[model samples]
Target: GNNSGNLANISLDDILNERVKELYWEGFRRSDLIRYGKFTGDNYLWPFKGGVLSGQGVAAYRNLFPIPASDIIANSNLVQNPGYN
Candidate 1:
């Protein structure tokens, strides 16, 4: 109930670990990791990142989803996101 005492001394890593346990399968992992600046770069790598067995950092632009090809073709003004093409 009263977690202030625990929160007072908890580190970012501790909070992240706890979040993973508490929010498993809730789809918050990507946002959480991005908020903590661990989504990209080699600082944090999960299983099979970039198709590598050991995992590896991905391009920074990978953070944003690419626009669909159909949408771009339909709308001349619709530009694809960076790093997609």
Candidate 2:
């Protein structure tokens, strides 16, 4: 929208990275990192992402969402997983 065109020297990578930062907190960081091949690697990381300050690949078991006790009590159809409460 701006006619100044002062950033003609900016590289495509820089522009894309800037946009990714702008949309990071809006729930695009995960997909963006996956697309860029940085989600599960040591090169690029964010604080407290995978339960570490420096970021790392999370354990597969950590992906489970534990069912609450109350829900189990009310629903007999619910079967508590072997390793979960």
- Indicate which candidate wins on TM-score: 1
The collision pairs in model 1 are none
How does model 1 score by TM-score? 0.81
lDDT of 1 by residue, 1-85 (tens): 2555534466898889999999999989889988888888899888998789999998888788999999999999988898998
The 10-residue segment of model 2 with minimum total lDDT is 56-65
Candidate 2 Cα deviation (angstroms), residue 48: 1.2
User: Residue by residue across 23-78, what tens digits does model 2's lDDT show?
Assistant: 86798755665666666655656787678887776543433457888999999999
Root-mean-square deviation (CA) per prediction: 3.0, 5.9
The count of residue-pair clashes in candidate 2 stands at: 0
- Quote the lDDT for 15 in model 2: 58
| Model 1 ranges with Cα > 4 A deviation | 1-8
| Best of the candidates, lDDT | 1
